[model samples]
Target chain A: MPLIVKPTPAHPEPPAHKIMPAFATRFGPKLAGEVAATDRLVRVNALTALCDALSDPEQAHGCADAGVVETLNAHVSGGQDAPTRVLAAKALCGCARDARAARAMVDAATPAAIQGACLNDAEQDVRMHCYDALIRLGGGPRRGASSIVAAGYPKALVEKAEKESVGLQPRALDLLTSCLGNEQGLAEALDAGGIATCLSLLGSMEAAVRAAAGRCLAGLCFDMSAKDAAVEADAVDTLCALLEDPDLGARRAACAALVSVTTTDEGKRRMVPAEPRPRDAVAAIIALLAEPDAYLTTTACKLVANVAVHPKVRAQLREDKECLPAIDALIAGPGTDQDALVAQHARIAKDAVLWEP
Target chain B: MANSAYTHTTSPKPLLSKMKKTTYRAEDEENIITNNIMFDRRVVRGNTYAAQVVTHNTQREVERMRYESERTLRRDATCQRKERLAKPSTPPPAEGRAHIKAQTDTFLEELSDRPVESEAVTQTEAILDRPPSPLFIPSKTGVDKETDIPGGDLFDFDIEVKPILEVLVGKTLRVSMMEVMEEAELDAIQRRQMEFEQMRNAELVEVQRLDAEASRRFAEKQRRFTQETDRLRQQAELGQKVAARAFARSYLANLSELAFDQLEDSGHFVDPVEKEIQDSFIPWLFDSVVETTNNHISSSSCVDALIVDAIELASNLQSDVIKQIKQKERARVFAVEDAQEIKEAEGTAK
Candidate 1:
């Protein structure tokens, strides 16, 4: 008897549907299965699938479920692969747009892992995504508590950042600084030994790191205790040093931070340097008025103008003839006339002399 | 000498001789006396007296010569003063000539620095004299004559009329003829005509309302039918999910399938489920998802999308929708005509 070979039926392909899954479906069992699977390729594919699904509004609704939450939590708890964990963190961030998803994310133990990924991830994009996610997570519950002991997870992250080398330090420091924007988080960072870290970062070789540190210090100084902490850490001196940074942007950020710190009476007093005002922040800004870049000059002039208005500051500036010439040079420089900021400074200087008794 | 001469006597001469001698002698004595005086003076004065007289005469001559020399000196002084007074009063012809020379030199210097070519200078001078020709030519007079009568000229045919006859015997004539008709009768006729017009307007209004009602009903039915078809298609595509959810799934499935198929075809396959989704579900699900996500995203991002969609939709729909409305209005006119015919037949039957 001849062996008969069975012919396979030609299955017609399904019609192409261009619809995206809703949020709930994006985080549904199908995506969860992909997330839980041990196969690397499959896991990557599933992450991609979830990303695609979340890209659609309807599909994003489907993914706003416990499945996405549980999978993300599992990855944060056990996963060691940085890329996969980064993707998972991103998906959670996507889901976090919904209150339920945000709550679920907050309940999950993934914040620490996310913070770690933000610190250690080689890809800048991934790190940025992680920071974005953490920011969206309400920066966690212990945000504005007075002491680090009161701030459990954030405190640990700060400690870890404090122990890390300078190379690995900026990311953690950035995350901490980002958290400093929040009331509770800022308070916690200040209490959890964030002042020294931020001050050290202010001296960082990277201009962006210095800028971030200055920005964080500005936030910390907004509160009384944090302001005192900053004063003790010599934040004024550090920020004043950053005013001389080769990067104009860093200098602008430093000047902005100094302006914020000195705007208050207590902050102004605390920010005054010991020993001949070693980092005369006002003087530093006045010096920056000579910078060739129009933007930098404008920013510096604005800062100077702000400082020149205070009666005491005005008196101090009047005593320094060097400051007048620098300001004059800034006013006379190319493109300065077009800048409203430079013009404002010019007016302030005029008022300082003309209006004063 | 005189006493001696008186004592002596002399011999007498002849009488004629004595007489002649006396006369001649007297005349000689007289001449002698005058010459004697003249000569005596000339002798007494001698050369010295004559020299004195000549010296006096020479002195008078020298005085006259000195006076004339003084007069000539005065006249020369007066002429010099007059010349000095007249020097600066007017420029001399030589000075004017010098000025012209200086001007010519200056002009030559300027020309040397920037020489005007002879041809170009002549051309500019020529152009300055004549006005440029106009760009267009005038048409011939007869070619543009008025072809039709103007509105102003048409009024020439208008006229006013007046009645000549005042009264009539049997029938009232002209003006009185009009007064013969009663106002009540005209009023009644006008009232009846008005009522007829009102009735016709009411009928037309009824027909329009019915047509509108029919069109509205038809539109509602069409909308329902379209919606049903869409719902059925969505159900078929999404299986059993709710409409929104199914739309979402179908969209995601379609996008996934497209991406997967592209990947597979490119031999960069990452997943196979991406190829299993459908296409029709893409846009609907995408739009729904985007709308849902609008609340989730930043307000600025949502506003950006909304603005873009609004501009695009407004531009696309403006003319098309206007055309559709115009077409519907034309159809309504035809429906009104049909209703009018039906009404006329009903009126005849009644």
Candidate 2:
């Protein structure tokens, strides 16, 4: 293919108005040439570079005009090797980072279908890249699968998130945890079953799953609307139960999550049993004060403080008196088995109730 | 106003020289205005009016092709000499006095001669003050000293109007060009708005597609989770049944061993000699063969009979244990079969 065009010397420097079009014209055919190259290996290498180039937002902006995006669509669907297809998807991910680039790709191809092909790739690496790219394309982390499920980019895009392979679910949840930092991102996530997924993952045997879910729920619990949604999903009850996870990391995450929940009025009601129970949210964290893991114990203190923030939660803690004694046991130690941080957290938790603001 | 001026001048210009009788008779403003400046003024005015008139004509021609600047330029250049005949800017600043214009001399001569003929009928005073006679004429003696109208300088305003004319022309050209550029700018804004709309619509479509996909995936996952839970329950049930069957087997073996030990300890205690006698002497055979058989209540055969009874009891106990083992094995097989059937049915339902 003739990709290069010699400039007419009659006008060495075309006016500013014509420069973009001139480059836009050159861009399309060159990419098409690369796509049409009979040498598969060469095509793959060229496409990798092309995808890499387009990942640059500036290059992505120009890609659509140059027909680069359309050709890339062809490459992605062109029955390339696993690596080649994955690379093409990685490029799309770069483009998806920019609104304009994402629009361009959407203009010419079905992102769902492309992602599905990458997802179906038997290679774990291929699937991983496809997922990463999906997240960039606004399928952001925990909600990425849900977004893909809702917007079937592929003609037959399947929701395999339930059977989430290794490396996908944890990463997805972790991403969503951070996504919750922004209001809009959190709203989007909540709309996409983020609450339910977190609830489900809370019960998962995998510690990573439990941890990510806990972190995500922690963010979710901060918002009243999300908290209400979580309550409907029995989030407080689930998280309160999770405070006793054998895995210290999971226990710490659960503690953090419960902190957000118990801070809310409804959460406090659920955590403090209607009838005094020794194994409720308050009792659970009290038990954690005796734990050797300083982080877990500290996390437990945070939950205790958070729960104690609620008037009812505070009254219940004072009524049970189990929490105070547990905390007293932790602080009364002769500094041998007791972690100072744990002791500090225990004091803060105690003060959180006794020294009511 | 320029057109009105052009039309008004066109009507009276031809009649100026041919007018046979009167000078300024009509008192209409146009006529009085004409009469007031008719002679020295008219002569000067005539040349100057022609120059001004020429400017109006050329300006109209230029205005006609204002949008096509090249065309207007060509038209102006093509008619330059013709227009210059009347206009001032060609040799500029009204070369009026130096030329002393031949037409000006004739017009004044006609005016000077007109009263001589009219003097034959009218009063001498009438012809003297009639606008033409007293007008200063540059003669062999001196320049027209009686007239304040600068001979050619009357039209010197044309030179000043030259720069003004250039400014006007530039304005016309600029307005048309600016109009075109403004229109282009509007078009660009509209195009950008359209592109934005298209992109926004595309994004909306993408969002919708994602929404559907999320629904579909969640539904699938829900189904899978349910199926998995069912599958796990079935597996747990199967594991429990296997454990129960193993326990039953061990318990049955212990029961059989205990029953066998009880039978061994509870057996009749018969001496070897007594057991041999009972085997050798059947009760009926001893009664028939021995005439001297005393009627003893307790015979030696009694211990032997007890020994035989004990042997019989032990054999029956072993058979019963064997039968129980068989029953338990059958029950375990039936339980396993039930579990397998349940698993198969569940798999098919799935």
Candidate 3:
């Protein structure tokens, strides 16, 4: 008997678009022209290729020309065509990392339209692109301040700012916070129930909301009248409650707020309770250390450790045995000193134990 | 001896003359011998020599006279011996007859030893022995406790057989062995069996009805589910159509705005065709073309090099929007087709 063998045919090479840099570079300049011609289908294909090419930082700068900036700005200002305008907005934002392009986008009259498009566009992609543009516009010095103040951010955006600030494009809440910096704008936000809104956002289920609210409160805490308003509004209790928040960023913000509020002698004295009275605020910090989340636990430990050393607050700490086990458990666990705040607590706990008789 | 010999010859002649006078025949001689053989044999064997001589002389005459008798006796003895030899030996019939008679006598003796009751009385007793008492013993004490009477007291009076025997004589007698009261117990058992059978049949019918009802309910649920699914499918179709229309309008609007922006930037301004188109045409047109082209090919291509190059700058923007819409449509279509194929395959397999 004879054996028969079958040979496998060679696979064909994929089409040119499927190929890499060579085709991209070869066709890049031509595709850029096609994108400018307003041929919808051809422009989509070309821009898709261009975006791919722009992923490389070196290639990204090349795509950031004045013509591209003009096209993007035109689309952003263009009404009714949400899908195309959104795509253009996103590409412009991507290219806006370049200083010149970023400045050009800021100078363009369509920043408001882009911001509006982002907030209200029917297409999710277009709205997301508007968000991307806003983030880019607010990321830097030149247009960051002005564009943030000009963009009439929606309430939903502020709510989103509270929930997902980190995952959010950087400029979302930052822009809102920067807008709040203006006295008139701050007074308006407060007048428009912005204080209650911020307080409510601080208690949001989302960590980002708590973090953004905390950061906003920190900024607002600088003004003496704002501080008085915050204290009157019970902003301290809200911030202290956030010390047990699951998100690391929110917990860190709470710790920072506590540190800032206690920095002044008068601030410390005000936060401290009257003599022989229990400090519920200090107890709240001690309770936060019992949270299961490592970040919240560590932050709470540090806050308590700081409060424990205060002459006025020391008597309360010595009386509370609950603080001792949590301190011991934190020091016994791995990575106790990994975080600076946790390390500070460890040091304070060591001193507190050492100074005991 | 000579004188006797001469005399014997002369005597024979004289004897012949004498025989002629009485003519003794063979038949007659045989008869005489048959009659005297028993005594003649004894006389011949008992005589001495002298007596034998005298007897011999006498015997000669007698023998001559009784020769037939002697011959007949010898022949009879020979026949008896031959007959005895022919038959096998057996006990006598008289002994067997005696034994039968003794057996009959013993049977009669035993019969006599029985109580001397009359035949009618025995017959009545046999009949009475067959029927059990209708009354039952109330307890293990063997007393009719319900009546406060001992069981033995029930049959205390003697039964007279004489008058009954006279009445029964020459009449046909019937003896029944059946227990009379057992018939009622049999009837009760039969009634219980009928009731149990009725109950069993009713239960079977009820079970079948329940099964049918369950099947009906199951079919009803299936029909309801099918109707609900059809309603949902129609709603989903309407939603998709609306979404598509809105998307198309948005695409067209954006295109016009882009074109207007370009015209504004150009050194030479072109005349507008339609105000709506002028403001929204270029961007919308760009988005639509990109969406259409993207539906055909997902990968970036320079297949239509000239056309592709003309829209290269805006292609990424348009393609992003197109990709999202096309992806959603593709998933919907694929899911519908896959579900249809799966249902068809399952039907075929079943």
| Cα lDDT for residue A182, candidate 3 | 51
Ranking by lDDT: 2, 1, 3
Note the DockQ of each predicted structure.
0.00, 0.00, 0.00
- For model 2, the superposed segments whose C-alpha errors exceed 4 Å read A1-39, A50-70, A77-81, A94-115, A118-124, A137-159, A172-194, A219-229, A232-234, A244-253, A274-302, A309-352, A355-357, B1-350
Model 3, runs deviating above 4 Å: A1-33, A96-104, A107-113, A140-147, A150-174, A178-194, A205-208, A246-250, A258-284, A287-302, A305-312, A322-357, B1-350
Which lDDT tens digits does candidate 1 get at residues B36-68? 333332123333322323333344557666876
**What digit string (tens of lDDT, one per residue) describes model 3 on residues A163-237?**
443444333554455555455445545554555556766776667667766665554454445556666676666
Please write out the lDDT profile of model 3 over residues B218-257, one tens digit for every residue. Answer: 7778988999998899889989988988997888778777
For residue A159, give model 3's deviation from the true position in Å: 10
B1-350, model 2: which lDDT tens digit per residue?
66541222223322222233343443332332222324432343323222433333344446544645675567668787687777665353464545333564535544344443322232233432443323233434211223233345334666778989999999989987876686587558644653343233323323333453476468779999999999999999999989988998887878866776776556444557766766765655786556434433235466557766766765575466445434544654767776566556446644
Q: What order do candidates take by TM-score, descending?
A: 1, 3, 2
